[model samples]
Target: MLKELEKEWTENDRRDEVASQDRPVPWTLLASLAALPIAAGLFVGGFFWWRGRPARGALSEEIAGLSMVSPWVIGFMAFTAFPIFLSLALSFCRWSSLTTLDHAQFVGWDNFRSLFGKDTTFYHALKATALYALLTVPTGQLAALIAAMLLNRESKWIGIFRSIWYLPGVLAGVGMSVMWRWVFHHEHGLFKTLIDPMMPAGWHFPAVFEKDAETWGVPAFAFINLWTIGGTMMIYLAGLKGIPKDLYEAAEIDGALGWKRFRNVTLPMLSPVLFFNFIIAIIASFQVFTQAYVMTGGGPGHATRFYVVYLYNQAFDFHEIGYSSAMAWLLLLIILGLTLLVMKGTKRFVYYEALKA
Candidate 1:
């Protein structure tokens, strides 16, 4: 019985091999499908390579070249490039909600004039947003740096603690904002309860809504923001883990203690990470929307009047699309300028690990 089974298996394998050898190849079908694109690319390349010799069949070559990238090129022009141009054009015009798109009369520099001249709200909001960025960016970087240092230390359950620190960041956006709003609730919130007990009978705990009160003058908006930025801190902690322990050991051998090791070794090594987090934090803080929109609606008289919120109000609520486009362009310029400044400044401080690489 075993001999018969072995013979049958051997025969089956032989039959499978024969069938595989006899099967038709798919190279013809693949080659046929690939030939058209390959031919077109070669033609376009040849055309560009011999630019002066491109008098003949230039239009045909251009057409063929465009045919390949038509979908992407068209989409890019329609969605991105055209819109940017349109916004730029719109910034030079004056248009309101009631005005038709075609009826947007050209009024050069009018919108920009309005932004800087009569618009005191824009000035106030911009100042407030700048102040928020100043407060949040430095503080957030310091917090992340401290967390990174703490987590870099040798510990068994460091991963678990790291997750705990990052937990606030993963909370659903709406849920996190709502949770923060509750914590900042003036009358019966945790913050109020904490402060109320310590105060005397005559002096009551002031709510966030009570703008008139001088005693409870805490900026609740800023507190809410800081609470949600714990996730960014975790990212820095991870960056710290990627650093070599040997560097620290070398520093210690050189008689470097806590502050010295941190200043000379840790700070220089982590400069790239710090630069990344600082720029990101600045951009995010400037465009702060969700927390302010959900919690305050840029209220308490525009206390949380972030740049994006202002843009959103201009676009949607005011129905000033042209004006909003102008604002968007201004913001784009601002962010681009700031990013360029960061890149330029990074050369002085950011330490790339060329020795290790």
Candidate 2:
């Protein structure tokens, strides 16, 4: 019995020995792991402190400058940067604005594919917007330049005239649209009440906001947009004022008359301002929404259905927020490409040093 008990005790000791080999990790090792990051951080802080010791005063001023700009930095990160990145991410998602982001599903290129393949409204909106940009940019700039030329002279009434021209620019966008509605109101409008009677028999004014909208709607909007170019006119006026009078005098001496002086001297010198105006105007033209939204509500059919209006409809009207996000990115890419192309194509024409057009 004593021998058997000794053997059993020996067997228990062997099992315990084996269990000790599989013991929990050492506290020392865990403590070292926890301290490693703190040690590294301290080392980095010490190095930077030592390096900046000589320029401590400069370093403080830099910190102060950063402190002053921190609010703006924070605001941009919160408002602009976050939304931009979120929109980009959401473009790849099948998510509605009405739903929580947690509900988002990953759908790779389906949104973009639908945009290019199946959506007819997207194509119509794109085409209309492209045409509007093409028609308006050149004509609008020309009109603004002419208005500037007319107002660029010395006169007692110059301030009043300029104020008159620029007042329309500051008018509230919605108010302007409302006023235009009255002006184009089929029956009691400026055209219908006054000019329709003076027309030849069987002739009638075009219902640009309604029945004849498909034919004349975009052009009507383009014409109305002329009044808003007062700001552009003022810019052109400033550019005109900057042109060296000597250039015009030299042209005149070389038998260049009024038109010749304008063509040879004025246009070339004003090319920089022209370039600036073109870029701003083309962007504004593509993003045209308020007038189309208010005046005709994108109208009887897709007549005045501009790109942004259609995008807005897709988002709010149809609740295709993800699709709308895709459209937004697509428009951004298109505008960016067009801008690059224009910049490249007009590199020779945009005279920083007044090269002849």
Give the candidate number with the greatest lDDT: 2
Give the clash count for each candidate: 0, 0
Model 2 lowest lDDT segment of ten: 12-21
Clashing pairs in 1: none
Report RMSD for candidate 2: 18.7
Error of 1 at 5 (Å): 90
Q: Taking the tens digit of each residue's C-alpha lDDT, what string does model 2 give over 1-357?
A: 223423442343211122223333233554577568768987998899667655778878877887899999989978987667567766766665687655556666767876787666677788888888988888899999999999989999999999998889889499999999889888789988888989999988888788898888898888888889899999999999988888778898899988988888888899999998999998889999999899887766778889999888768865666678888989889889888988999899888885232
TM-score of each: 0.75, 0.83
List candidate 2 segments past 4 Å from native.
1-54, 354-357
lDDT of 2 at 261: 82
Q: List the residue pairs that clash in candidate 2.
A: none
How many collisions between residues are there in candidate 2?
0
Give me candidate 1's TM-score against the actual structure.
Answer: 0.75
